[model samples]
Structures are given as C-alpha cells and as structure tokens.
Target: MSGCVFCRIVAGSVPSFQVVGEPSGVAFLDSRPVFRGHVLVVPRPHLETLTDLPEADLAGYFGLVRRVAAAVESGLDAGGTFVAMNNRVSQSVPHLHTHVVPRTKGDGLRGFFWPRTRYDDDGQAATYAARIGAAVAPPTRG
Candidate 1:
C-alpha cells in the first residue's frame, strides 16, 4: 500500500489533475485516460481486489463511483459512460479501483472488447449470464 501510486496520490504525495476525496474513498482524473474525463475511484483503505474489500465498504465505494460518474457526465457532456473494475486476470495494478470513462458518439470504444471464442447460441449466453448473476447478486443479509 505504501508504494501504490494511487495511495500516494491520495496521500497528496503525488500531484494529480483533479481529485475529490471523501472520508471513505477518493476519485481522481486518470493520467492515462482511455477517454476524456476519465476518472479512477479508489478506497482510502488499501485493497488489492474487489474480494479483498469488506462487504460494508461496498456501498460507500460504489456510491462514490456513481457520484464521480455523474460529475464526469455533466462536466464533459458525454453521450455515455463506462464503469469497470478489473480483477486478477485483467488487473493492471494491484489495487482496488474503478474506472469511470466518459463516452462520446464518435468514440471508437465499442465496449471493452477482448478476443474470445464466439458463443454458440442464445442458450449458452443465458446459461453463462445466470451463473455470473448468481455470484454477483448481493447477499440477502447484507
């Protein structure tokens, strides 16, 4: 956590373009943006992945993410937005963060695409969705 760039930015050790910090988390403009008005939301407490986050922090983290997304949309007048958090396989940095990217009509990004085997049919797609959805749904107690 000490050597993490995001932690350094949150600690004010590194200069950032724009930053919004709350008691729970921090949001800042991405240095290497995929699109204009790109922001990264990170929790003040260091975490390596989504699973590493406590369930109680989930709401606060995502709430900040939504607020930052709204700011990006209004400030940039973007047509749309993309929110993403890469886990172990796709993780670029060993820190928990969410990317909020502003999308415009002419922007070439057509969803975060990666080469993959084609789906055989709608049934396969549905089955895959079901499995992922089951895992993604919040716990009833939480």
Candidate 2:
C-alpha cells in the first residue's frame, strides 16, 4: 500500500483537499473534479476495488459515503448528487473510492463521458472542501 495514492492521502503524507476525515474513511475533493464540489470517499485502510471491501466494513464505509452525498448536495446548494463507484474497469486509482458529484438541472453531463475540470487553485479546492465538510452531519442508524 506504500505506492497507493489513496493510502498516502489517508496517511497525511500526501496533501489533499480533505472534507471528511473519520475512523470510517476519508473524503476529499477530486483533484480533477467533474464539478467544483466533487468528492471522493475512500476507506481509511487500503482496499482495492469494491469487491475487496470486507462485509464488516460495508455499513461504516457506506454510511460515510451517504453522509458525503448529502453534504455535497446541501453544502453546494445543488439540486442533487450523482454517486458512483468503478470496480476494476476504469478504476483510476485501483483504490476503493466512491465519487459523489454535485449535480444541477441542465448541467450537460451525460452518461459515463465525464469531462474533468480543475479548481482555480489550492485555495479554491480548499474552499469547496470546507463547504461540504461543514454540511456533513454525524451518521445516524436506521
């Protein structure tokens, strides 16, 4: 896991625009965002691909992801959110990460053809992270 970028980010060795840092996982702004407030949620420990995730970790990891999706929508004042995960195919980092992207009507995003965008600077990225981070509420059990 030493060479894993997600592991480095989770370990605080590699800097990222972190939104949620918790026992369950870490959520951060995607460097190449599909939208300004796009966030990627990954488990605290390294796990490559979704199937690699253990059954015991499912609830906690997904609870974190659910919270992030809500935060992205509410914090960014977006109409809704698009949450997705790529297993082995098109799995850019070879890490178990879920993408939570803010979406609004008429945004022009269609299907899987995601056109990536960048923040104006690190400050801009941080701003996005802070916005979503602030709105993220503590997880509640059903």
Q: Which stretches of candidate 1 lie over 4 Å from their true place?
A: 113-142
lDDT of 1 at 122: 45
- For each candidate, the alpha-carbon lDDT, in order, equals 0.69, 0.94
Show where candidate 2 strays beyond 4 Å.
Answer: none
What TM-score do all the candidates reach, one by one? Answer: 0.75, 0.97
Candidate 2: clashing pairs of residues: none
For model 1, which pairs clash? none
For model 2, what is the C-alpha lDDT against the true structure?
0.94
Model 1 lDDT tens row, 50-141: 99999988887887787777666665567778899998778777789998877778777766762223335545434432332232222233
Q: Over the stretch 39-130, how does candidate 2's per-residue lDDT look in tens digits?
A: 99999888988888899989999999999999999999999999999998899998899999999999999998899999999999999999
